[model samples]
Target: MSQKVREIRLDQIEANPNQPRKLFDETKIADLAASIKANGLMQPITVRPLPRKVGEQGRYMIVAGERRFRAHKHMGAETIRCLAVEMTEDEMAVKAIIENLQRADVTAMEEARAFQSMLDRGYTVAALMKELGLKSRNRVLDRVNLLRLNPEFQTLVEGGNLPPAYACEIATLPAALQVKVIRQVSTGQLKTAEQVRHAVIALREALAQDDIFAAMPAATEKEVAVVNRMEAKVEQIAALAALGFKDNECTIAKKVDPNKVKGMADKLALIRNHLLQMEHALRAAAAQGEILAA
Candidate 1:
């Protein structure tokens, strides 16, 4: 396989049909094209020979330069600098994927899909793991797991609204529960990933009990519902407080007596304490059930 750098016409070069990467941002591509127009192509693309067929002249197939090709097209450049090479289909696919991964802004889903593609193309998980500088098999495995996430959740991740840590948390949940958690997050019921994680763990623990329905206290449901509502209200108040409203000022500004605010604060604290006690009692009941079952 000879390697020679040459200036090839942009119209003549074609993107590899087997490129593992699926999505590309037009804005980023246009930006890159503008940059390339201002500064000549610093790096050349890699390509392989395309076998000719009857009644048609073949064109060069890109192996590792899809971004540059698209950018140059956006720039309206007639020709592009490329490095011609010869490689088998499998090698070309890997090179195409690795080239995209080298970009700074590649999405996690893209990376996951690319890795999965390589795996499907006969690469071992261990081999790809080493190639990607992954520390453990589980790290590689986790990327693949992202593919299992619902498209709505995946879109959230790709859009940068949801963090990967949160996505991982959602990944452990059943699809139906994943939708529930996402809805809560979207509706501001769950403020942080930590809150979601705690809720998930608590729910799992509750469900694991043999007679979970009976093991739980009769008042537990009502208590928990009240606590959730109160917590939401507290969060709203805290947000208001963060905007420079003191408890006393808010109360007085609303024409309520300052003493009333103090009294309410004391009452809320007491309610919070009672909620904690209710939680503890529920836990104790569950533990007793576990002991009896054992």
Candidate 2:
């Protein structure tokens, strides 16, 4: 790599195609330019020679220091100090990504994309961890997983409006329902990452519930709380049933009246009869051979 601190013409330099940074704040740029104008560009930008095309000759592409370049452009300077270096395209991409990532404002989505781009080019996770100076594989994987977020939520995460961890937790939900989870988060209905995860689990359970229950209209907060308590009881009963425990084992279970148990049995028998009737109805419909065998 040839590295030289050379003064290059601003007009001859072009923006890097593989730069990980997509959005730049004009206000921040103006501030940086003011700083540079007063301090005289404390650090230099990095650039590489570009192959001449048509009327252009001795042109360069920025490998790093895009912010400074923009600042200089804001100042209308004719030339800027550049650390000229010779690097391959891949090397240039890595340098640009690394440079951008070193900044505090680099978005999670940008980091994820930069990591993914290197990974797609045959780089291993371990290699990425080392190059990116990450302490663990989980850190790298977590950033990369941000790509799984829905576009709307991804934008939120990338813009720093939504926490990346919240988005990551919500991304585990079904693709169709991720946005709803994000909405819940954005509205402060879901507070923590754990809450978002639990909400997702509950949403999935609701989606997996029997059609008769799932099709019901939305309930009030108190109604939802009641249903949640009932669901918990149903789960406990299901576990007990699986264990072949016919009688009550706990104090709460023992508090139930015997007549209540008998009434529940009668209701269960009625439900069984209803199921049989449904099967019979389906069998009647099977005459045309449209319905398959159970």
Candidate 3:
């Protein structure tokens, strides 16, 4: 393929109608355009010859770099420097997808859609894995799973309303439950990812057998101790309030100030996060039935 960077008028370059990627965030495009204006195009976009009829004006279709192309248009740039290359339609599509995916910020859903498009176009998963430098089939499988998610969930993800990790958890639920969770999240009934995760676990357990909460392990000594300390702090604060101290004074009267309370909260959060990590590790180990020597 011939490679030469040429400055072409923004109006002359056209988006390929056959491009596999359908969704583009206008806000993200605009942001990219602003960045381009400040720090010029760091990477050149790839394009191919536009199939035109005889006696028609020659045009070039973007094989990749649609984001850059759109950004240039939004920035009202009269011209863009692009790498014009000669390639077949299939080659252009594949190259374009690979180029866009090089961006670290590309969403999992977008990657999945791109992979699915390539698969539909006769590219095998193995081929895609090689092309994309992906090591595991499960990595590709995870992205493809996003497509199976409820459309509303997909919309939330594409709109950046739902984080990919949370979205992945939502995708694991049944379609009916997925809708229920999405509604709860959108309505602010579920305010955090942790809450959503717990809800999902409860729902799954409930479905497996009634009264699942009854089987939940009793609070460990550490957890109980943490709860007791928190309750004691609250009681002390309340007693100070009862002593006629103003709210602000009561806050200051505690042996541990608000900052200490915040520090304890942070410590608790770290413990909780560590426990979650351990739980995941144990589950993975159990799945593989691999025993640790130690």
Best by TM-score: 2
Candidate 3 residue-wise lDDT, 37-124, digit = tens: 9999999777776778999776888887889989998998898888888887768768867876787777777787888877888888
lDDT of 2: 0.79
**How displaced is residue 83 in candidate 3, in Å?**
1.6
Error of 1 at 92 (Å): 1.7
**Model 3 alpha-carbon miss at residue 81, Å:** 2.3
Clashing pairs in 2: none
Q: At residue 149, give the lDDT of candidate 1.
A: 86
Q: What is the lDDT of residue 117 in candidate 3?
A: 79
What clash count goes with each model?
0, 0, 0
Candidate 3's displacement at residue 182, Å, is 2.9
Off by over 4 Å in 1: 17-21, 202-294
Question: Where is model 2 poorest over a 10-residue stretch in terms of lDDT?
Answer: 285-294
Q: Please provide, for model 2 over 1-294, each residue's C-alpha lDDT reduced to its tens digit, 9 standing for 90 to 100.
A: 888898999998999877878888999999999999998989899998887778766889999999899999999999999998989887887888788788887888888888888898788999878877878787678878888877877778877889887877776666777877776676787899888776666665545553455788878899999979977976885686566444544444455587697786688689679768966765654521321111
Output the worst ten-in-a-row residue range by lDDT, candidate 1. 285-294
- Where is model 2 more than 4 Å wrong at Cα? 53-55, 203-294
Candidate that beats the other on TM-score, 2 or 3, i.e. the better one:
2
Q: What number of backbone clashes does candidate 1 have, counting pairs of residues 3 or more apart or in separate chains?
A: 0
- Between the candidate structures 2 and 3, which one is better when assessed by lDDT? 2
What RMSD does model 2 have?
12.2
Q: For each candidate, give its TM-score against the true structure.
A: 0.65, 0.68, 0.58
